[model samples]
Target: MYRVMRLIRRFEERSIELVHSGHIVGGIHPYIGQEAIAAGVCAALRDDDIITSTHRGHGHVLAKGADPIRMLAELTGRSTGLNGGRGGSMHAADFGKGIYGANGIVGAGGAIATGAAWARRNDGSDVVTVSFFGDGAVNQGVLLETFNLAALWRLPVLFVCENNGYATTLTVAQAVAGSITARAEAFGIPSVSVDGTDARAVYAAAQAAAARGRAGMGPSFIECTAYRFDAHHTWEHKARVRYRSDDEVAAGRSRDPLDVLGLADEVRDRVDAEIEALLAEAVAFALDSPAPDPAGALDHLYATGLRTRDGNGLLDSAVR
Candidate 1:
């Protein structure tokens, strides 16, 4: 778990550097402080279990076993990316690894996870689906409706909410009326809140919730309370958003998730060296890869390989 968290931290840090150097375009939402939640939750999940991620999702994808090289390539818009450079940072996906995709929508992944759980149940499979979202998603009607449906159908779904105390710029205290767990309990789904910085605590909660799903109990909810150590997005680094005070951010950083690892100094140094080597290779691979060709832009747009029709009702002769 600690190793996974460390990898996620370094990956995000390198991604930020790439953004600054223009190797990775359009910026990214750094997952520096929220490593423990993704590491712990994914550590508890089976290899076959499914997960749906949010816009701030690089950590989740890495924890769920994505190749860092391909992921970085995707972020850099290289043709060798996980999604052939089409999905980019926000939509990086590996279906064979049970990761559906990192959605750009705020709370839409909940519905997708619920539907996946329902389908898996009908197939007589014990597979569970996890939906990872932020605090902002709790207020979305689609997410609430998904909660209702998951509970009503007793679907094997675990709704993991990474509440970093803000919905973009709006603080959770300022925006969320009542508690986050109460919202899930309103729908009769068992819910719990855990210290998001403590990977062990998050792991315990996730294990219990996953067990409930596997035992055919129903959907469960876990609200992970952590702090975002960096900007909501890389753009904010340049925009210089002033929502958080320096002291508050300091307090948050003091409870660093990496501190919980407690590894020996020698072990830590060895692990750090290994991670640096791996990241160096990943960066090289991403930079060396070619960009996607514009002519093949619509290649994987549809599964059926259907081509668009021309204005005169004839099939377009382009190389679809």
Candidate 2:
């Protein structure tokens, strides 16, 4: 668990560097402090169990077994990306790994996960699905509707809320009117809150919830109270967002998740070396790879490989 958290932290830091250096075109939402939540939740899931991610989702994708090289390539808009460089940061996906995709919508993934789990259930399989979202999603009507449907139909969906206290610059206290757990309880779904800084605690809670789902006990909700060690997005590094005070950030950083591991110096050194080597290779691959061609931009726009016509009812220039 600690290793996974460490990997996510290092990966997020490197991504931020790429964003600053113009290597990665658009800025990213760094999942620095919330690594424990993703690491823990994914640790308790099966390879076949599906999960949907949020905009700040690199950690979740990595924990779910995405190749670092391909993921990095995707962020850099390389043709060798997992989504052929189309999905980029907020939408990278690996369906082969049971990842639906990291959506940019606040609560859209919850609906997608619920639907996916329902489809799997209809097919006579005990496949479980997890929906990961931030605190901002609690107020989303679609998410609440998903919660209702999930409970009503005994769907195998686990809703994991990474409540890092803020929805962008809006604090949870400022936005959420009622208790986060109570929202799930109102839908007749069992819910709990766990320490978002402890990977083991989150894993145990998620494991129990997944067991209930597999046993046909319907959906479950877990609210992870974590803190974002960095800005909400890499762009904030240059912006003047004063939502959080320096002291508050210091307090949050004090509770380092790596402290839980207490790994020996030699062991830590070895892990660091391995991660550095792997990231170095991934960076090289992303830099060497070419961007997707504009002519093929609309190649796979539709599921049936259908082509669209221009205003003249002829094939688009790209397709032509």
Candidate 3:
């Protein structure tokens, strides 16, 4: 858990540097402060357990065992990237690792996770699916609708909401009307809220929820209340958005999830050195990788064995 959280923290920090250095285009939604939520929850999952992530999802992807080298390459638009340079930061995915994708749309992953759980159940597989969303997603009709279906059918889906108290600058107090957990309770789904900074607490809650799902009990909801230590999006750094006060950010930074696991000084130093060396190699690999060719721009856009039509209605050999 400590290693994962530290890796995420350093990775995001390095990504921010890359953004400033012009290597990573379009910037990233840095997952700096919310490391423990991803690390702890993923710690409870099996290698076969599926997870759907949000736009701010680098932590979740890394926690689920994605290669940092390929992920950084993807962020830099290199062909060697996880998605062959197509998905970029917000859409990188490795299905073999059970990461469906990091969705750009808010609340979209809920349905995807539910569908995955339902399919796995039908396959006679005991695998569970976890949907990681934010506080902003609770009111999304799609998520609520998924909650209804998941609860109604007793799907093995765990809804993990990373409630960082804001929906892209809108405070939860301003946006949420009532209790965040109550929203899930309304659909008769069991729910719990945990300290997002405490890795142990998150792991315990996630383990219980995953166990319940595996036992064919039904869906569960976990709301992790953490804080966004950096800008919601890297663009905020240049735009200088001032929705959050400096003092509030400072106070929030005090309870950093990365520090919750108190490892020995020697152990911390060794891990830091190891991660630094790994990130150095990852950055070199990303920079050395070539960009995708324009001629094959349409590749991977359609399903395999599917054909396309040209203007005259004949099969498009170019795509074929």
Model 2 lowest lDDT segment of ten: 256-265
lDDT of 2 by residue, 127-199 (tens): 8999999999999999999999999999999999999999999999999988999999999999999999888
52: Cα error in model 1, Å: 0.2
Instruction: Return the clash pairs for model 3, or none.
Output: none
Q: Write the per-residue lDDT of candidate 3 for residues 154-180, one digit (tens) a residue.
A: 999999999998999999999999999
lDDT of 3 at 109: 98
- Evaluated with lDDT, which candidate comes out highest? 3
TM-score of 1: 0.96
**Candidate 2 Cα misplacement greater than 4 A, ranges:** 310-320
Candidate 1 residues 20-42, lDDT tens each?
Answer: 99998999988889999999999
The candidates, ranked best first by lDDT, are 3, 1, 2
Instruction: Kindly give the stretch of ten consecutive residues in candidate 1 with the minimal lDDT sum.
Output: 304-313
Question: Of models 2 and 3, which has the larger lDDT?
Answer: 3
